[model samples]
Target: MMAQGKAIAVRRERVDESVSGQRIDNYLLRICKGVPKSHVYRILRSGEVRVNGGRVGPTYRLAEGDEVRIPPVRLAEPVASGPTPAGKPLPVIYEDDALIVVDKPSGKAVHGGSGVSYGVIEQLRSQRPEARMLELAHRIDRETSGLLIIAKRRPALTALHDMMREGRVQKRYLTLVAGRWPNPLQHIKEPLFKYLTPEGERRVRVSSDGKASHSIVRLVRRWARFSLLEVELMTGRTHQIRVHLAHVGFPLCGDDKYGDFALNKALEAEGLKRMFLHAAQLGFVHPLSGERIALQSELPDELRVFLDHLDRTEPQKHG
Candidate 1:
């Protein structure tokens, strides 16, 4: 445990196989309990943190046997506000020695930070203290509900990352958008640039200088004023699905960012309280077994109820 209220001397750690391939920023965040994320990045930017006697970027992946030099920083003492919330067990979709997949609910973050005290990963770690290793294979937005993958071992995590990078993993989402989709199927290829607002809130936009992004959208159902779409991401970028859909003039229902504000307000009043996006399906090969793995999560009751309401009141144009 880290001692609070005083700066400790710098320490050096040698990477082992268990921790190999983890990003430097994430490694620091895990080890440096109570340290603010901004401070961690500050130290990284200032060259205070080093790997093998040289400065490394935050995204640098650790290799086995690499020596990491962690600088000293003071951590604030814990305040006894109340008892820490117990880690509630999430709905498990699948689990094995290699990984665990869970049905993550909408509005819960995958990991804790930036004003969130605990999230799905932290909750899972708290629940399974006996487990040797647990790490996120990928991430979905806090407001996006659906299947999430957590690796039980480092090798599995590394393998899963490679598979995703190679586009061997297929991810599909179900979302309700504002407007009638013209085509039965359409491919949206747009570049997305991420930037902070004047107040430092992260936001992504379609820009010429942004990284390439692609989404294949298939219309599932259409109402007089809304359309349900199945979106398959060809490239995983931040807010890829939301931004791409919104950029094409069909903002996702209840999406606060990059959404129709007036429609969102009306949606909240009509019982569509959260973003209408669900990670409905995932298909990939098992990292350890080399067997195929396919998983699906049905839309949550709330989202389904909203759709039912739409069907009851709105005229259906397509199905």
Candidate 2:
């Protein structure tokens, strides 16, 4: 139900030929984009939405000539209990000119979704009030951290987006495998397919025939129990690294998605928090300047602490 505070008058935006065949609720949600579907439904269920002054069910489809009326609601109002900007994001690296790459910590999502108030991009907005533009060049899973790119201006955004589409953006990651890897250097040439569950969760897995995926992983260090590997992806699938690595029997440390829950729980009890993967390196053409650039993020605190624990548990192996 829409909030009981007070109904505010809302005029629906018009849609023409392009969106001629969308459902009413879908159209309303698009017009009220960013407003939660629940909120939209709240207004709808409370008799706040009407077509030509007549209450309409959510499933009521729309046609060319329909007058939609939305009851009082200010869509732009910030959600209640919004967090202060600073507490929301942490930046590990910053640069002047066209971009800023942050070494994000685990647990903080790359972009805010679900119940989160803000993500990395939202926090970075506060750092540059003068600039009218800022956006993420690429994304890393919320539980994963490393070099995350942010385009500071429209030109940079356009250039970077083009490069990403052309596959010129090179991303390298470092991950701690759950067990000693089978090969010193491995390349998995597989195809990937993304499956979305009914609950809205997305999972990517390997298939015999799907989107062509390939990545070369080389052993960086070996311990009595685990191995650190440098992984380079030639094709970027949703959960490519996590899924591929796990498919080959060496899931990333603390990767609850494709990794072992028992191991994650054991590590959590030992204060080994979050997933253990990092966007160790990222290289791309400068969106505006056309200069070649590569950025790296030093391992974060949580990763450092966990590695230190491994060093202590099996010093000889680290030696």
lDDT for position 21 in model 1: 82
Q: Write the per-residue lDDT of candidate 1 for residues 134-175, one digit (tens) a residue.
A: 899999999999999999988899998999888889999999
Where model 1 places Cα greater than 4 Å from the true spot, the runs are 1-17, 23-29, 32-76
Off by over 4 Å in 2: 1-84, 92-94, 315-319
lDDT of 2 by residue, 1-319 (tens): 4553433567874544334444678767866755678988887888888876788778886655677887666555445875557654466565667787888887777767777767887777666557555678778888887788887654566567777767788888989888877677889987998888888888888987579888899988888888989898787788999999898888887887899889989988877778888889888767667677778888888788878888888543544
lDDT measured at residue 1 in model 2 versus the true structure, 0 to 100: 47
User: What is the alpha-carbon lDDT of model 2 when measured against the actual structure?
Assistant: 0.77
CA-RMSD of model 1: 4.1
At residue 117, candidate 1 shows an lDDT of 79
Error of 2 at 25 (Å): 18
